[model samples]
Target: MEPVLRNLRIGRVLNEIKKVPNCMLLDVGCGFNHKFLSTVEPYIAQGVGIDFKVPNVSFRKIRAIQMKLNETMPFHNDSFNIATMLAVLEHLEKPKQILDEIARVLQDEGKLILTVPGKRAKPVLEFLAFKLGIVNRAEIEDHKKYYDLTDLQELADQSGKFEIVHHRYFQFGMNNFCVMKKI
Candidate 1:
């Protein structure tokens, strides 16, 4: 993942967050640095970041854990008020199941905000990664799928755990931003 592009995705997600004081947040695939969590620390009361390689430690109001997203999550039900998966949905082998887990851990009507490469980004991302050498080749190569708005909506629908609240294409339509409310 390119740093600028990852931050762009994070920015788009940030716009969707409703500045709720004391928000309990769950950030999936927060990477080793928890950059996004760091940025949103002020608005949230506390946060938990889960990733395959996150440092297993606790910060002031944030916790980082090494957790495999493809498996079941470790938290109890209704553990979070907001959950985010910035640029992460497409990397999962079991996207639907992961979405279900997100729903399961969220409080009723909690928001699940996520981003992924939109369908139209495929060729451009490939060109950037494979030819231009701008994006991370291994990262783009690892993506299992690209999603469109309908794909996201359908995934949310199929889980029967979320309702589409908002969605759009950003980054010049190369990326998708979706907000689903837990049902």
Candidate 2:
């Protein structure tokens, strides 16, 4: 991904989570770098990162777990105060199931922060990222779908356990950012 786009997404997520202090965060599909978790470590009290693969580096106050998003999360109920799934929801084959799991582990007052490629700009992004080689093709292939605001709202609705708190387009409408609260 382009640094500017990446910063926009990551920065938006970080900014939203910063409002809730001393939060225990669960970063779903945190990737091998634990990049997001590491970036937010200073603000959060504790954090756990789960992905299909292990991370290459470890940081204090953050635990890394290797687990696929499609499967049951290993944590118990009400395990976290905040949960984030940056750029991960569109790639899930079972997004509803995973959202259910995320809701299960989050406190009733917990918040979910996430980002996905905007449906309107996805095709153009694919063309630029893949054919033009402006972005990583390998990363683009991992996405099963791109989400517009409506699609994201529907997913939150289908979860039956969350209410959309905020939704907006960012990065010049190339991406969608959502903040949902467990209900």
Candidate 3:
């Protein structure tokens, strides 16, 4: 993703968390570089980042774990105030299960903030980012599917545990961000 777009998404997510002081967060698919955790550490009281591999370095407020999305999360029920899956849902084969798990781990009023590629803009991104070499092709290779707003809403509804609180298209409609509350 473009740096500006990535920052926009991250900034928006941070803004949401800022509404609640000293939040505890779960960051799914947080990569080995600890990029997201580093940015969020100072703001959050505590955080856990789970990915396929552990990060090389750890932050003071964040714990990194190596794990897959489809498997059961190690966390207990109602463990966190917020959960985030930035550009991650599309890469999971069993997204519904993951969504369910996210809901299971979040507190009753906890929020889920996520982003996925816009289905309608996939072709354009493929052309510009992959075909034209403007962006890294490998970065898009792991995506199992792209999601439109409807697909995301359906997944949230199917989870049977969350209610959409907010959603909108960002990055010129090439990406989507959604905030859901545990219900």
Candidate 4:
């Protein structure tokens, strides 16, 4: 399959997988596009993809379904070795709840990977749009939250369960990438 945004998102996950070996993996908010599945294919023992919108299950190869992120993930306790929340947290109303759920389903030593927009990207872009009056901040559905380095760190640190292992600016050229790992 040709690469796209989903592929880009999954690439980040695959980069992190090199640090851990032979693990079960879950991709939260994996959509019908399944653009990123190929990245994780070779490394993960088993991969489960979940999203709210129904994705084309036929091509996914891995297990997938339509499910809400705010609700419970349908699996046993400590079901996965690693869980990735790529570009999904900023869209939710209650991101903390989802983080809590991720913690509950992950093994004590399991890892969680999170990526969101960098601090200035969203606000600067949105502010540019506001000047033109072409977009309304409230109407922008996908971005429910924005984070600077400090705020993102706090969110990951105070998750109630997970400890922040690594935090840094993930970048692809001029674009900013915010990467956080659950410890």
Candidate 5:
């Protein structure tokens, strides 16, 4: 129903947000509009959104910054209570480094909520983007990889920075949802 799936991912992230107390959030790859940040505005005390392309708009509780996720963030250690990388991991060239950086910035035991397309979505996504012309072709073309639940668990285990506290599949098993706590 949505274009490939932004709304579904946002809903999943919001559900994870509700499990934690009010927090200062770091939203990785918050796009030009800061839709997710805006949607969660009431749930967070304040927020910082970073991406390679973000507008200069200044919202009341958000400071949008144009920065690359591959580089270390400017925040101090344990700077945020929660960090989210909704649908952003698959596009990163160095995803583990980015996750490590996220872990560095999050307070101890803080949560990292993320969603990535499942491995099964490869052909489905390709068809939606190329044939049906529904999903964003640019995004599908940019995906570095798709992951399964085992892949996610292994990645987090290898990082030694986070533990996948909760995980589930949604969108008819086309996507993965995870709540990882900083170890």
Candidate 6:
């Protein structure tokens, strides 16, 4: 994971977990990268990591599920204290739909934490490719769209089921930190 993104997630998650106890967390689009998971090991009672493919890790404590983002989450309602989607929302077709599902599965007043690249963060590379008449962006990369601060803020506000507890600009707001609480 990139340092800026990784650190931002770690910091936000730690702060959020401090407010709750016996926490069970759900990590969406967890991939194989579990740095943040390891960081919260002390506070987490049970952790579930879901991705399209399972990463090779020997730890049996962390439950990794293979699943698609656009479908229903397999867990029961109000199953977790916190749900995290790190560097993942931009990859999905209906991000708000996913958030609704997250709200469904999380306890009332549960927390959702996520991070995504700000709209301006990678514009230079994208623009240079345009000038060179070449598409350098990775096709498999899950970034369907990049979001500016206002877009993210609006998404948080109109998320349908959750209240934006805290939203901050990261990496100069070219990246964003969003904390939503289930209403």
Give lDDT tens digits, candidate 2, residues 103-128.
Answer: 99999879999988888767887898
Global local distance difference test of model 3: 0.85
Regions of candidate 4 where Cα sits further than 4 Å from its true position: 1-8, 56-61, 124-140, 172-183
**Residue ranges of candidate 5 with Cα displaced over 4 Å:** 1-4
User: lDDT by residue for model 4 over 1-183, one digit each (tens)?
Assistant: 113544665666688876677778888877666545556777777778888875636443377767887788888988887888776767888877788788778877788887676655575547645665555454344687766567666776678677666666554431234544445
Q: How do the residues 26-140 of candidate 5 rate in per-residue lDDT, one tens digit apiece?
A: 9999998888899899988899999888975677888898888878899999999899988898999988899899999999999999999999899998998899988889989
Model 5 shows how many backbone clashes?
A: 0
Indicate the worst ten consecutive residues by lDDT in candidate 2. 52-61
lDDT by residue (tens digit), candidate 1, 102-147: 9899999999998889989999999999999988898889999999
- In model 1, the clashing pairs are none
**TM-score result, candidate 5:** 0.95
lDDT of 2: 0.86
TM-score of each: 0.96, 0.93, 0.93, 0.78, 0.95, 0.83
Query: Which window of ten consecutive residues has the lowest lDDT sum in model 4?
Result: 172-181
- Using TM-score as the yardstick, the better of models 4 and 6 is 6
Every candidate's lDDT: 0.88, 0.86, 0.85, 0.68, 0.89, 0.76
C-alpha RMSD of candidate 4: 4.1
**Global CA lDDT of candidate 6, please?**
0.76
**Residue 121 displacement in candidate 6 (angstroms):** 1.3
Off by over 4 Å in 3: 56-58
- Tell me the deviation in Å of residue 58 in model 6: 8.6
